[model samples]
Target chain A: MRITERQFVELIRKRAPSAGGGATVAGLRHGLRQGIGDDCAVLAHTRQRDLLVTTDLFLEGIHFRREWQEPASLGHKALARGQSDIAAMGGIPRYAFLSLGLPRRTGQRWINEFLAGFLRLAAASKVVLAGGDTGSSASGFLADVVILGDVPRNQAILRSGARPGDEIWVTGTLGTAALGLAVLQTGGKLRRSHAAFQAFCYPEPRLRMGRYLRQRKLASAMIDLSDGLSIDLARLCEASGVGARIVEASLPRLAQTPLRHALHGGEDLELLFTVPPERSPELPRRLGGVPFTRIGRITLERKLWLIRDSSKIPLPILGFQHF
Target chain B: MRITERQFVELIRKRAPSAGGGATVAGLRHGLRQGIGDDCAVLAHTRQRDLLVTTDLFLEGIHFRREWQEPASLGHKALARGQSDIAAMGGIPRYAFLSLGLPRRTGQRWINEFLAGFLRLAAASKVVLAGGDTGSSASGFLADVVILGDVPRNQAILRSGARPGDEIWVTGTLGTAALGLAVLQTGGKLRRSHAAFQAFCYPEPRLRMGRYLRQRKLASAMIDLSDGLSIDLARLCEASGVGARIVEASLPRLAQTPLRHALHGGEDLELLFTVPPERSPELPRRLGGVPFTRIGRITLERKLWLIRDSSKIPLPILGFQHF
Candidate 1:
């Protein structure tokens, strides 16, 4: 059996000292506030702000197929993924560093469109392109995007902050992106206006909602749903040393989407977070035009479960696993 | 004609706003102090220290061949390359974020050896592996390392700081790395004790020397010789809006190495810096056991020339071009 990405990360974490583990340079104290297991590595920047750094690898054929998506869409997704990490940390994305490896046959026009798409979002998000390295790839194109963001000092929402009594909530409808991919896989047109197509191609990170939740101190724990609900929730619970039980009927999805898609599909780029029972009443039904759905609650036992029509069943931890 | 990496960078620079070009986040006055066209992106971290960030991509088949080097050497070089960028900036590397994409056939043993090599150098350099992302590669293995370092505010040396009449100095023997590569290409056995082999396999970044030069205010500008002498010098000159004339006789190289390897060969990873004539006397001939040689001087004319046997000739800007 192949080792999962989580296991690999654990291997690294065990081998490499934690960032905040009292690393010193010339007897001066300088260390990351948070590292590895979180969405973004948090570094103490200034007295006023903490820096959030997140790197995402967007590899060709593995992460996306060139034939299925346009170069512009690829560019957008590349930056969006990292921004979602920042959003999950309740941070504001500021600068982006992109290391790109272009294949031999790539043209100047393709690069221009890619930059156009990337810069369009950067401009909208107020993130500046800082610096990066470029190389000639032997095979397909690859891009690793590093997003730097800022959050109030010691105020970042973490996956380990969830308590057993916290209720789990999510922003936007689930599984729409997987449905879009399903259509694309079956050779359907990418209708730009369609919600499913839009969700897959031009998926937006829940930056505003995350910031609002953090500012209001409403969320106890947060993570972006880049993977499926089941796996990402598993990660959050694992980090918190707790489990979760979600209601199947409360899961939000389009009419055409199967329950499996909502439960196990990936790349939705929505915000999944937990709130204390007392804070749940103050949680908005909608924020920044995105619907918020409450479908789960953290559990004391270390097991994932789904309540379907009053019947409790184990929830399969199925999502995209790179191994 | 294929577009050169520099041209592609220029295209990006023109398309995206410069990092320091008044980028605002929520009306806050935060921006990068330096961005593209440098060894590292400089960001204002605190009143006492500035942060330096540099990302380097090491692609399989492009940067190195699997058969030519061990997985450990590959890992060492990957981290070393980014550390060299930090060294070139006269900064102390504090943290590293590695995004790795492993091919399908990669085994656990290979990964363990790679991390051993990477972590060894990281321990020596006092760099903590803060965070990273991992994925499965469809083709060749790829790794991109992002290094974060710190320097005294406004004290980090830059390629743009060179001025006319400045003496150009370099550390260690040039072209030894290329010699090692040539030996490898010719099916020669790798002798670990050989300087050339060592140079190519695990080139040491001039971190201590760079810090000494900066602390003493001896270097006006600095750059790393990752690309060959001719091209890297040209880049430094271009960034500084000046030119250079190097004496071929003064180039430091092994007795067995040809001059062409010093002039046109790449991946030496030595520090190439500019010191004013008045400050040259104060510069050490050797620092931290590495020899330093004065080979050139900044010129008023904006042209690169090689002074060989008292005759001047154009220095062909021939180095590694990844286009």
Candidate 2:
């Protein structure tokens, strides 16, 4: 017979009489007006600042295999995904709420390591770990990271500003992360110190570049290369009511890498942005050591085309998809 | 052989070309500075208002069994849990970020109904569904709701301010929701139209009462009864370094209900607060047609006891536990 509700309540209360409140909670940090043990957390924000909010979902099998990645890195990647969204908006992330669902039998040590990894990024970003929910999942793990950020009032850069004749640019070399993933997928025991392994395990977000571009009003429309060049560019085009013509030769890639990988690899976390023709000269060759390549230009026609040597053709837009 | 990433990307982009951007995104409403299709949602706020944020977790096989609840009610309950946190703090909820990890084969219709239910609460609360993350899960469903609200500068109530000798009060009758849950748990057929079912399925949050108490400076410390009186009040006392004493007969319970259910049932969503003895007379008997009863008084000692039939005894502090 199933235990009655009263009996269950009695067992739970007898086992843990302290309730959920405690003097300290993991993931608490400075700048949190209200910490754990409260109904809601209180945070302070300036009036003229535009708050940036973003959330990202990660599932056990869909996002990670758990066999190849450590708990710390998984935690890092989860927070990084949400933080990258803030970076793409040219906003400074300040607070984070992490909700997680843990499957039965996961060790408390696993959680400690995950929190350690998550808090590392939070501390680096100067973000306060404020509030979130976490409970047990019967089958597998799931996590959602919500980031709260802010920019100067009305200073947010959107994806709706690119027009015809704007110059398209990309930061960092393409296809490295894809190469890293390929290495990992083949059961290649690569040294974690290898560049490809690092790229796959830890994709650096371009937050500083986004801020510089937004503050200087350099980019007309901007989007991160989260879904690869072909697909994400289509979204940027769709948003701006314009088209794109990128030269295959202009894309910066690792030596001898396939052009397809450079064009189709996702998770690069680089910035793909457009600058008007007049301000194109103001663009620097390099921003903080990362290479900036002028890969294409916006066009009057609202479609994506690739200009190969001597001939131009339509390119199929594609990327990593969750559903 | 594993499907090539290129082929997978093509399939995904072809299937969902919009990349989840569309006319109808769930949990979306006004007060959204930037909606779907943006890198991050930008929101407007003021310095005079401190931001209130809360997140709640719901897991399959833990919070609710799918066999017992519909997708719509599950969605409603998920969002309501976070909204109640805002009400408990005497703040107005403004924005929401919902993250869901859906299991395989859950179907699009399940998603549609879930959003329908979630949006209903958003519309009623005047809360905007700003941004969130959603993805496919490998196993069971998990949902996390993050609510953003604001309270006037520092007027928001905390659980750590109740002093000794304060009159404790509670709003609404206790044990109704628990009765409804018990009915459902015992395999009894409960129509949605029944009062018991309504009490369980559609628990109304006491936002107006919390606000009135805050505006009038009437409550010293306030809490919501999500985890029953015994457990939740323990949290309040622990937070404030005080204790509480209550006459068993003073509690407002449904007629013919056992006192045990009134003390241990979770998810009632009623407000329990303390008012200073000097200003207890200023408290209203009814606010927004909800009944209020002076349940007992806070005491100088840090323990909980029930006075009954000329004798006092220790009350077992039992309610709900997630782990």
Candidate 3:
């Protein structure tokens, strides 16, 4: 019989368990502090630091076909997805926990290669693979990467901080990762050394740029472009109770690239942030020499718009959704 | 076309990206101190405390067949698996992060039921479901649960602490979950209200008992019996560089239960611990109404054995292995 989540929770609550005298640790320890419901849970942190945690799931076939991707690249992308989330929050990732569900047919050589890719990026970013679980799957592989990061206390960049008249900014090119995927899907690989090829297989998280934006107080709100600029910006507006207007000419698209790909193509892993008008000038044009561009402005209209040929056109929200 | 993990890491390391002056987080922030290789990652905690982190993976078909199992029970079991690891370390669980690789055919109704089952156990145990990742899987469902827990510094028990002459103890009954599974598998018409069924479906992690044992300094080493007594005990002995001798008759077996099931049946989330001769008197006969039994003692022989009546027999290590 199919059961509803509501009914299940209700039944459980009714049968909630209690302990005999002094058996439970109820008042003995400082347990969980925040979240049965929230985008993320919060733990009381050490002095001057706020801990940030996020988890990402990567499944074969849905995420990447194992045949087309190297085991090492799969490993790298797995950790990269979670690291990108840490970068979005302007925090430095400290530890990574990987849970891999591999099919029983997987060979030892493949397993070792996967760990190599995963651990390399971790070492580059100073992230340690702390602990993880492994299990045999009858089907394709599934991987989950949980990353723990820390930001200066109260210095976290949240998508809810965008406000009216805030200048919208983006780091790096928009469709690089998507271009890599397009090339793979179309079976039109340019070259292994090509930028698009590398971008698709091994996208770098904008860690330094996120840190710069946070430390310089250059941005009011921030999110990573994992789900494309269109949907992610819409989410930012929704979270901040505002809207946005993007200048069509300002997008940093690769030559000959479709604007739609730059707008809706996901997996870019770039930072999309909004700067309050007063802090706009303090924002650098080049952060550590990586191009940073002003792409739009936050509006109070509560509608996303694109400024094309001096005309305001409503932009469609199209981005990747795992579900 | 296969790239070794070593080669991939070396290549990535050689091409590592760089940043401009004064942009990096620098020495201002202290990062993760341990856990590149261990069952759990350790983080410096507030004063005399240390953070313990562990993750567990449960896959459809491999760990459980969803066809027969209820959604609520699946959710409860998912969190229980991770909580048991925390108990194994003598820590209190704080937050749980789940990454679910759900099939495309899964319904909202089904998803809700699963979460209901999961959250119910969380609420009872005071663990917050802080955050998680969800994605579509072409294959059957897969879930990875990561739990963050804490214990007073250096107080968390490990598998390596058993000494010769330490008395072995176990909290709760052995093979109860396996019996439940066997009943279900054989389509035996056992009453729904049976304790075996409840134990199998809603296995409780001995969090309180683990804390009690650690605080009272009774257990020299500890491990939860996720696997059967035969394999888990062997592991404990191997870790401590010692052997063990168990009186088979002392195992708390259910009436009519087969001796084989008690030795090899997995999925029991009960704590198996060791206490020195001097400290054995401090352990209680029961905690939270769960029976505590002294099953055996750590021996210097470097081999695990079981005594039945007048005969001493070598016990084969036969617990579940993930890979």
Estimated TM-score per prediction? 0.97, 0.84, 0.90
Residue B4 displacement in candidate 2 (angstroms): 42
Candidate 1 wrong stretches, greater than 4 Å: A21-29, B19-29
lDDT of each: 0.89, 0.71, 0.77
Q: Per DockQ, what order, best first?
A: 1, 3, 2
**Per-candidate alpha-carbon RMSD to the true structure:** 1.9, 13.0, 6.0
Model 3 scores what on Cα lDDT?
0.77
TM-score of chain A of 1: 0.96
Query: Distance from true position, residue A224, model 2, in Å?
Result: 1.8
Better of 1 and 2 by lDDT: 1
Question: Where is the poorest 10-residue window by lDDT in model 1 chain A?
Answer: A20-29
User: Of the candidates numbered 1 and 2, which has the greater TM-score value?
Assistant: 1
Position B108, candidate 1: lDDT: 91
Candidate 3 positional error at B171, Å: 0.7
What ranges in model 3 sit over 4 Å off?
A1-41, B1-39
lDDT of 1 by residue, A65-99 (tens): 87877878888889999999999999999889998
The list of candidate 2 runs beyond 4 A from truth reads: A1-47, A256-258, B1-45
Which clashing pairs does model 2 show? B27-B129
